[model samples]
Target: NSKPKDTQQSMCTPVCLGASGMVHVLLREELLLKEHILKTIILGQMLSLFICGTAVTSQYLAEQYQVNTPMFQSFINYSLLLLVYTTMLAFRTGSDSLWQILKQRWWKYIFLGLADVEANYMIVKAYQYTTLTSVQLLDCFGIPVLMALSWFILRARYRLIHFLAVAVCLLGVGTMVGADILAGRQDSEGSDVVIGDVLVLLGASLYAISNVSEEYIVKNLSRVEFLGMVGLFGTIISGLQLAIVEHREIMRIQWNWKIALLFTAFALCMFGLYSFMPVVIKVTSATSVNLGILTADLYSLFFGLFLFFYKFSGLYILSFVIIMVGFILYCSTPTRTAEPTALPQPGSTGLDNAALKLEENDSETPAITVQFTRGEAVVVSTD
Candidate 1:
């Protein structure tokens, strides 16, 4: 008597009942993970646009309404974010230690806050003395500073390609800055060029330090935890500084709905920017984040076209496109050297031979083979 037909076939073969389904499931998971990465990058870019645009709009409104106290803006922005996150922390469960973590690592956040404040202050203060040309030129030094810190402090490994990518990015930035200078942009605002240039340079360095600290925190702590800590410190530190420095000036400024709305929008964007930064760091790095932000100047130019009717330089447009190319070149390609998972080689062990036989009886999926080539692991898939 013949057995039931379902029982007659070999269960291990490619045509078995469940083999194709298993492969489909595995492939689906891989696809979903790739999709997640794509989504994150897109979201990060959108958030960046919001951050830069809103910040520019806020500054424009401040100038319009004669709001002279910038530090007050920073104080309110940090305070609002702190309150929001603190509320969130209250509702969330199973979070990392709030106060305890701060006690352990408070200095880092405090320093980050100070660096953030000082960088903004220095750049704003620089405008009182330096030409816009010098400020724009010196600001780019952050990239090199960040990369150096990443290499030395974070122990990041880099290759020649990485250096080339950074060079292309910086070259693109230099082109844009040079175009502004050659275009004979009006500088009716600067007073002491040398002192302001030095301040801008120092500000760029402080910005790099803050960015590195951000990357470090993102790598160690959860996004919520880090944001809460930063907001708490930023509000306290900036509030105290603002009170001492701008107490009289803030009282003189006109408080109106337009100013209030602009301030609210600015605060929201700051919150969004800080919140999304950790996700970007998780997806890529501080270097890539800086690269993405290199486009902010381009966005500012576009916004200026609408508001200020500034003459659009074809050279500036070309430089921006070049920067985009460099950013895409740096990001779209996987920079990490692939660590080939070493598969069992032929004749390495008796079980490896048995495994090959079993593989043949199984699905048509290729067998993974590993070989060492030039001290690097190379993996080959053989059917």
Candidate 2:
């Protein structure tokens, strides 16, 4: 009778342990799935803040320290980003040269580099001829262009209400900037405002194109590797432009601790922007990312309370409320499914195996295998 009882207990032990393991795996997967969207949204917000901070600091540096050469500034930013990517690649692939992959993807990244450098240069230069209000107002136009591009180029889907929300956000931006302009924000003697506005428009359009293309590229490729390739090519492109255009200007800029600090700040923020951008793109559409960034001015406004001793006006408050409504309205929509419509070339593997996240339990006694797709991950037990 004692032998029979002992055998019964032994039989139940493995069954109970296996059931517990299965329950743990399912709970972990469910938690991760829920947190993924939250993580993406937070990253998008951080990207906007970084961009706003970068712009503010860059303006300060230019106004205070007389360091306004766009070419040299871009070159330094791209160079530092490239160095970081190079180091990451070296660590990621020990004993394997990066050139093996570089040879196949050079032109793809060169095009991205060109678009990125041009976008940065044009917007920075536009500030010389136009008021900040004009630049900010016109910059919001990129969202519409990005929306159109997403529909045509990337196959992004949206509802009529979503478009309306975007329009409302645009209206808010216009109101905020228009009030500033009416309050004498523009220089009466500035003669090139029209040209500056046009430049800003062109720059915004180019950025829209670049952002759409980038979203498409990252949807089919590794986010980190794509950024690394862009940084490498952008550095090359910027170096050429700097040598051609800003050779003398770069040599003449005053060098001091403040200038050095500003450069470091700009470089760090730019790097952060590039790194997190792909993640946001992966989690949401290019249009969503643009819409999310519509709040950058809002961030700057709040930041100004501390830094610039700014007093929020009625227009600012109204604009902030309107923008918030649009943001919440936009966020209520579900993410669209952007299938791989076209590859850069025939026989490209980028379209295949997109959502397979690997989970390996190498630290445990018996390893567990998990395969992740869009909705859920399934765990496989190894005996």
Candidate 3:
């Protein structure tokens, strides 16, 4: 009887231990998921606020001071980025040092910077041609474009919840548009609505490209690297463009303390947006960031009521609430990487296998795996 009891106890020990381990993993995952959701919401809202600040400042400059130098405004922001991030990058020495990264991937950052600079210019230029409400609403066109890029480039797989959430967010946008029409806030004084709308659409598309590239860089590499490269290249490109296009406008401006202050405010807001965007993008995604920032329009509307003396509408409040709901719904589900493995190229080492083992062993933390193939480092997975 004693021998039989001992045999039964031994048999149950492994099963009990395995069951307990599985439960612990599930509980940890649940906790991590909740933390991720909270961080995403907070960071996303912060970015939305920063962008709203930029929009308000830019609109005020265009309206009050006739400061229509989009290139110059963007150039200021890029210069600040160069002064901050690129300077910090210069001190680091490693494979990721500024010179090393430039040697390996200079062209990539150039395109990224160009896309970002143009996107900013187009959106700012739209302010001179369109209503504040229109810029806010039309800017959301980037969400779908961003999602498509993420699908193809990042291989990000989303669930049905994400699509549903997007629909809800768009529905909220429609509500806002209706409110704008009801309030007669769709048109601005001395503005070309058609041209503004077109510029916004183009800007949004470019923004999608920049944002997708940002996600890839911040997730696979580092935020500092992305900002540093963007700063370096953006400063160069925007400086050249500003000289060519906005020199006359710059000359015509009646310099004043107020105008100078507004420009400084705009630069600071834009710099904050650039600096903090990578944090949200790393935790959530480009698509989600775009979705979350849809509320920036609502923020703009709130300020517009006081600054532009626009009439208030209950629909705007409802629109804000709806967008928040959609953002929350989208974030409730986690987006996972799809088929993360990449094929080995010529002269491949065992690093890819080691990375796979690391990913498996470290399931709790988000891991970025780099596969070396043909003298290049390809990002195989990020989670």
For candidate 1, lDDT tens digit of each residue in 45-72?
A: 6666866766576558756876666677
lDDT of 3 at 179: 93
lDDT value for candidate 2? 0.75
Point out where model 3 deviates above 4 Å: 1-28, 127-134, 188-194, 340-383
Q: Taking the tens digit of each residue's C-alpha lDDT, what string does model 3 give over 1-383?
A: 99999999999999999999999999999999888888888888899899889888978988898878888988999999999999989999989899999999999999999999999889878877887677767888899899999999999998999999999999999899899889997775436889998999999999999999999999999999999999999999999999999999999999999999999998999999999999889878988899888888789889989999989999999998998899889999978888756755536554433333344545687777766655566677876
| lDDT for each residue of candidate 2 in 230-318, tens digit (9 for 90 to 100) | 77888888888888878997798788888888888877888788878888888777777887777777677677666656555677778
RMSD after CA superposition, every candidate: 9.4, 9.6, 6.3
lDDT of 2 at 118: 87
Cα displacement (Å) at residue 279, model 3? 1.4
Against the true structure, what is each candidate's TM-score? 0.75, 0.73, 0.83
Report the number of the highest-lDDT candidate: 3
- lDDT against the true structure, per candidate, is 0.73, 0.75, 0.88
Answer with 1 or 3, whichever has the higher lDDT.
Answer: 3
Candidate with better TM-score, 1 vs 2 = 1
Give me the candidate number with maximum TM-score. Answer: 3
